[model samples]
Target chain A: MTTNSSDFGPTNPPASMNSVGPPAGVPDSAAFRSAGPPARMPDPAVVPPTGQSAGPGAESEPAVSLQGVTKRYGDKYAIRDMNLKLPRGRVVGVLGPNGSGKSTMFRMLMGLSRPDVGEVKVLGRNPGWEANGSIAYLPDRARWYADHTVMRAFTWAQSLLPGFNLDSALRLAKFMNIDLDMRASAMSRGQEARLMLILCIARSVPLFLLDEPFSGIDVMSRERIIEGLIEHMSESERTVLISTHEIQEAESLFDTVVFLQDGGVVLAGDADELRAEYGSMYATMQKLYRG
Target chain B: MTTNDWQVEPARPPGMFWALIRHDIKLRRRRGVVLPRRWRMAYAIAAFVILMVSVTLEGPKAHFYLNAVWYFTFGYPFMTLGISAGRIKREWRNGTSGWWMSLSMPRWQLVLAKAISSFIRALMIYAGTYLAVSILGAYTLVLRGTFNAQTMGQFLLQGLEWNGLLVGAAPFMIAFGVLLAILSSSSARPLAPLMWVVIGGLWWGIFPIAGASNWFAVHGSGQSAAITITPAVFPAIFGSWVLASICLFLSIYLMRRFVDISQA
Candidate 1:
């Protein structure tokens, strides 16, 4: 995952283009270092000193921000010098292959793991603080208590998560054709996947992180889940980050795309802009990775 | 939908703690590892049967049964270690802990809830067995016309002392078990039986090293020595309680900072 500074030289561009590499006009020595949130975008929640309104150019803050964040396990870096910003009210696809640190990045954002050297902020606060209430996460694997029936699982969620909408969850469950009385352990892998999706969608959080949500499910179920997700996206001013290898299937759902390789972003931009410049997401991704 | 529809209220810490405690209790019961209803019933029946047999064999010697009960109660630490260890290991093996970590609750709260719930569950089981034995002992004393106020008072006092010792030892045992499960490989096979053996061997070794092997044998004697609550025992009781608190604190600290959900 280590690369010489020269390799990242010209590949980095200015933030105006939502470039994947370093921001423009910085010395090569500090190119990789995160220059904190752009000067134009002052945080709205941070009150200006007495009798002062924020500048007119102040832009809405990102839903998630990672600055010079590096998470290491033993001697190996899981996430190395990563800097990313995900804007609100958009569906961002985090495209990566296996062992590309997708899960590690997600864990850091969820506050399950801490960065060794940098800062991770979710919804304007440190990850795992009050930001937790604003994020709904569905992990790659089923994590429910196997002994619990679907109804019991819902009950547990309702009790713990303040934003969990029981009525919505029940409706979603019915739509998915899942029995509330069925034990979680008794469900097949595909059924379990659907159940998890239903649970995540039922939460009314501002940020949603779906990690490998479509993995191992049948094509038909995947389509249904995708449709459900799209419906949810349309109804709310929410941000979503879907990490997946099923890029082809999920590309259309994304408003933005981030391509990760060797624990660092190789490419990132608005999906429509990338489509205009590079034809299609699949083609763009293929060219980028194959290059 | 209104703008308020999307607003997510912050989760109250106490609500989260209670929810986790309820979830853990349900989990333990379903897994049948800690104070399952069926096991409770089975234990009650066994206790009754033991009382009946002991009464028939040795009339008016019901106090003898107290010795057996005390020894059995003393072994609760070993039981606590096995059950708590198994419960934690199962959570890791099944990935429930990862789910728990994903929730919008503080890490310390989760650990504290589990520890409190597990300790209470173990206490309930020990209390049930102790109560049954005490009832039988009192009935036999009444039958023998030896149930005087002074004798009854002494019996109650001894019961309280024994309970204090057992309670003092419980937290450390359960906390250590939880710590081991949290630290060990999730894929490792069940270590409950092996843990029991190891704990038993360690206790045996400690008895000889502490020069308390004779005292241990005397404590187990049913009829030879009368149980007493004396000033001499207060230091050991205080030390045991202090040790328990330290283990519990360590368990919660490690769980908050070091537990790796990715492994689960």
Candidate 2:
């Protein structure tokens, strides 16, 4: 089967969206220049500053919506009926204690696991949008083949992902002090984590899902990684989801914090608003969780 | 991609699935890091010793190759199931399984790679054993007499029969290993290979028991132990292979469709 759109059929989406979703309005220049029938390509040209992207201050519909999405394993429930609405261009932090379903939410969002019940919609589609290069996900236990060097890993990722920008990834890797020639097996924990983060952040995509990026990192390494991620989010219209138990460190980076407890969303809102109303975001989350 | 000779379905075309498979293979190849040189050498030495012992002890007759090939088939499957399952467990212990499952890779691709990799290993073992047996048989013929058509025919039949048997059960064995990898935690993963070996021994034991009784004919227990080269043997072996393939495919499909990849 054709991994890309061109080989599939005439009805396939144009080459612009073939490997990666064109950010906003880049045309199918690749196909046009390659000498192909323009009519056969599904137009991946960005939706020009119009349609949903152009409303003034008006709210856009959520790219991801979940209602009562629950996952149960025999008696224990990972998540229960979690009602969540994620619009375009917003970083949603999934905050919860261990076993509170933060990871489960990420899994469901990535289509790794189906909820026992409820609905999940990502970018007006199911979770398998990686094929369209619209979503990028970095899970908690980020891993790399130990035999390959950082450069090899980067090349492999780029080959599989349409929007994976190798140059940006390499630059990010260097910025993080990761030695490109070092094999993955020999890299320190901090170095491997940095490499994985760099790869995910450098991808030219709209949705970036990061699970526990700051968890289990030394303060110095943690700050560097967080700062690098912040740079990635410099664009105004990209969405990021970071799940973490290190609330104190991650709280400052997120615009919205979603508090989950007992597999259900206990509270969710603007971080500043919640902190202002409840004193400290961390304390408020603890109190809410304890109760 | 054209519809002229290959288009059998109207839905999305076959390109999507082929792309999926190719994508999986490429990723797998890239990620297939060679083991440390020491590990590779150790395995190679072990395989050579086993082949040598089996050939030398069994002689150059049909009996020798049959036993040698059987052991060879069993060895590769056992090692592959053990090693692959162990790797999966290691990922679980290191907390990487969740990350891998979340990679947007279809679950079937994961299982497919595991099975296909094992199949490739099996072919290697098969080829090595075949070459060793052929050489030994040739040596024996030169010492005793000249090559005979009847003797060669018997040898071929025996080899084919063993092949059919190996192919038939290969799928279930691999599937069982994957199922264990999914169900068991890292600490418990090593037990899966042992479970398979025990089950295999029991499976063999049943044949002897069936042969000792006439009433057990309905169980079809004789096929497991019956080594005779007959027309019926090949068909029975092929039929069994077909059945195993279907079961393996279904097991893989169900796993891809429903298994909770989020679990540790």
Candidate 3:
């Protein structure tokens, strides 16, 4: 296991549609290609045949739960029949292809859309319950009032949302070096991302959902955003769910990784356990996906 | 586990309505455009001069001035709707609905708060015009020496009717404005209010041409009129209210079901 850490290397891979060149550990070229793709056998230990998950409090309740979640637009299925349960207080990563319903799931959880069938819950409440200051969601594309300054945006948040605290927001603004009085439309993408993070973190809400938080930012800004996220996570009751394809940059931050294909969960488990079960995480993942 | 899977009790009660209003005001101040003080002062002066001119021209003296006050009463409610449209459109164009959604106040509460605020603003505008008219009326009465108990009573009755008309319509107007805010996301929204006004005007205009514009016909006291309610005065008032209620209901439903802050 000493060399196990080196198996996943440092080149930040773009998670956008197999856009990341193979990072490391796997054969870089055609020479060491496997004869056949790897098969994913169900792990008997993880899934008890009884079909009953360990209930709440014995282990904390799943931060999210879905049974038969399906999203369809007219005749086409945007997402189909997904069942999942994510436990509370862990950093869970959601990875999927572009059309794989990642945004749909997040939107449903945030009460933006209704699932055609089954039920979904966040922080033990249906999506509508999130209105009671329990969940903080950062969207893939963050937008603010055009005429609103960073300070004004924070003030607006503080006034309308019970969870938002201006003092914490200002501290975050100062730390990020954002000019509070500048209009939001004038901000660079990196600054907007950071501001979104700042607003989300300043809230006292227990569950945080970040959808594609690190896209289109320079390396230095990304690093700073990551650091702020870590700082925000310092509280024990906080649970963070980040959806991103940039596995290499964010892999270290996640305690668990979930892979969604075609609106169904293909793989989910403790990251460490997965690495131990298979010699290489990325290599095994790629092979399994290919198959 | 089948029927009653995982149910979370609603965590908070419907709080005081004022809390939502206060929050909304903060949001407006933060995200909204503030009319410059100088422009506001200039507008006030211009309105004052216009009211004076209309009163002089009408010559019924009290009646003419009352007409001016009536027009002024409509201004506040109209401005409430118009300005809200502008604010919401700006938010949509800039893509800020995501941030707005994260606030998580129940949709109904937000709607109710907005209605109350708009109503209150309408009252203020009416009050300003009421005072100005009252002053003008009193001075004109003093100058003519014809001021009497009957005239004062008439003024009181007219005031009651006018104020009642605005107050009754305030909720519908607020609801209509908020719906406009929601629907403004569609590109075809700018014409909505204009269409409403034009339709109303056409209805009233045609009624006069058809000879149904007389007072008896308007109050529903006459049956022999040619075009009783075709495109004119009757349907415009009640129709707008009905349409506004439906649109408001739709906006509330979408805010509750389809408003996703996570997309922000």
Docking class of 2: incorrect
Instruction: Give a tens-digit lDDT track for model 2, residues A53-125.
Output: 4123213445466766778976898986566665556666778789888888887787777888988777656
Best by DockQ: 1
lDDT (CA) per prediction: 0.66, 0.58, 0.59
- Candidate 1, position B226, lDDT: 49
Ranking of all predicted structures according to lDDT, beginning with the best and ending with the worst: 1, 3, 2
The TM-score of predicted model 2 comes to 0.67
Cand. 2: chain B TM-score? 0.55
Number of clashes recorded per candidate = 0, 9, 4
User: What does candidate 2's lDDT look like per residue over B1-264, in tens digits?
Assistant: 111211111122223333433333322222335576799899999997886676455544433323234344545545545544554555555455654555445656656665565555555666676666666655554444545766555555556666655655555555555556654542234555776676588468746643653311121132123354344344544654575466457546555565566655
Off by over 4 Å in 3: A1-60, A130-132, A146-156, A162-167, A180-186, A273-291, B1-17, B26-91, B121-168, B179-264
First chain TM-score, candidate 1: 0.79
lDDT of 1 by residue, B1-264 (tens): 233333345444347778888777643433323464598899989987887887756756444544344555667777877666667677656655556777777766766676777787788877886786677667666877777776565566566667766776677777767656655633232543565576577678755643542322233344434464455455655665576566567656665666545644
lDDT over C-alpha atoms for residue B150 of model 1: 64
Candidate 1 residue spans exceeding 4 A from truth:
A1-60, A276-279, B1-14, B27-66, B131-164, B183-226, B229-231
For candidate 3 chain B, the 10 contiguous residues with the lowest summed lDDT are: B219-228
Q: Which ten contiguous residues of candidate 3 chain A have the minimum total lDDT?
A: A40-49
Name the lDDT of candidate 3.
0.59
Q: Against the true structure, candidate 1 has what lDDT?
A: 0.66
**Could you give candidate 3's per-residue lDDT for residues A87-112 as a string of tens digits?**
66567777766666787888788776
**Residue-level lDDT tens digits of model 1 in A84-183:** 6665566788887776678888888887777888888886678873577778888766456777788987888788775788898898888787899998
Pairs in steric clash, model 1: none
